[model samples]
Target: MTPALLESFPPFNPEVRLQPPAIERWRRGTGTDVEFVHVLDSGRPGPTAMVVALTHGNELCGAIALDTLLRQDVKPLRGRLVLVFANVEAFGRFNAVEPFSSRCVDEDMNRVWDDAVLRGARHSAELRRARELAPFVDAADVLLDLHSMQEAGAPALTICGMTDKSVPLARALGQPETLLVDTGHAAGLRLIDRGGFADPGSDRQAVLVECGSHWEPASAEMALDVTLRFLRHLAMVDADWADAQLRVPAPERQRLVRVGEGVTAVTPEFRFLVPTHHLKVVPKAGTPLAEDGGRLWLTPHDECVLIMPSRRAGMAGQTMVRLGRYES
Candidate 1:
């Protein structure tokens, strides 16, 4: 099946210029080799912000961002910067699935960042890189995991803002227009938890940002600006970093259709295949969403918000599914 996402940026030559630094290397699993680009700044060493990309093979926005980030001349004020262009093999796989090939080569890379799997020999290349990057995480303070989605929605802020400290950062991030999802966990642990650290004893602030739909050319540029803004926000970048403000466009807001339920046919363009029917409703539960097996199927009784209604992608399920929303 074709993946409803895409991205494109120039190649990044780490050695061509002075990058943060290569702190370490992890084993790249079968048919894959991985390397992490680690950079350290002692100018005013304070907090550490680790930026990672390409956890998913097909998610290209982050990859493009990494290319641009690697090439940029960023001098930090305090703390350090860890820039990683991860999952080389999965990322290198030619993704031409649908809109592009579903870039998921082995399995979803983001879903398998478990320690038990990492210690074993059965894990994939991504898992190993996640484990390798774990240590650098402990040495620093912040982590920004970049990603994209399958549908057309506002460039969202999916911060794993669960802790007291991280919550403030996430809240700051989810400002004028943003949705905060408290994974009911800490900020920097599990890859999803934002607490995913290499060193267990270190303090870390982490958040995952879904820039926009896959294949957005502008998404890469947006990521660069946001990273710069984030650095300034953290006091890592120069106080007067050039144009470090990044905001969502008002028109982009209209694309965020507060995804209702039911099996609304998903067109490749990331829009509803047909006009929305009376099948689903937002902020409401137990409502009939769509027809399955020729009968009215209802939504689960919960405060759920949907995103990226896909008819295909995962195995055996309904034609479409709902994404859990961030409770304000």
Candidate 2:
């Protein structure tokens, strides 16, 4: 399906539970020369850790959480802390009446992270912003890109993009119960999958946190809790300060969900057999899940779990859902 055709689908009309925080105060950052990028240096030498929000403009939970941290004047004790409000241009377009319309102006910002794509001739609002943010991303030793889901009722997950280094970082956060390990979309590379962040040998690691449903108030709290835990793990922020902000108890053990395959829509006629929630486990192999152009898509393995089943209109090559299995 064409982009125009996909966009013709109805606007998302979910009830707005989370209020979008006013970020005018943070437009000009201290320390970092860049706009909307705040850098806090402790003067003592340590790894630079970054927390990025608003990759998709409609996802407001991250924005709220980041704004809270900035307002609190949460500074690192040892290393540098970089708090970024990315895709602000797109974020400026967000409206409660039509939240999904503001996802991007040109293209998905998360998809254009490959070196060739950034250095190549292709230009868009997202590409230009990614290019501008490249320097900060390159310098970071550890990073957290915060995001939210389109579908509600899905459990929060930390997406560790097919790298061993990121696994421990996700484990360290420990609030989000599931850890999703994948290479990323077939469309292009994600920020977490870009350059040294995805390299196993490199100390640099990045994990994208899908906090929860876009418009849910709980999602914002989840984002804040996870962000604090991440900073505490890196020893960037004081333990007492970080602990005071947490609203949820840390998970005793995190379940590892290794993505087996992404079910991409081959035709626009993709339809799920039943309404499914995220982490919905199918007990048997060959269980019918979806249908595409008269062909039935079944579960490939027993105890198959569905992750992030798309509620939006499916286009050709778009990920309709992801199938995964639990690891030890």
- After superposition, the stretches of candidate 1 with alpha carbons farther than 4 Å from their true spots are 1-36, 96-102, 161-165, 174-176, 182-190, 194-203, 242-283, 290-297, 300-304, 313-328
Model 2 agreement with the true structure over 187-230: per-residue lDDT tens digits: 78899998999888788999999998898987899999999999
Clashing pairs in 2: none
Best by TM-score: 2
- Winner by lDDT: 2
Please, what is the whole-model Cα lDDT of each candidate in the order they appear? Answer: 0.50, 0.87
Model 1, 110-196: lDDT tens digits are 655555555567765656666776666555577877776554433444544434345455544432244444333111134645344
Candidate 2 lDDT for residue 241: 83
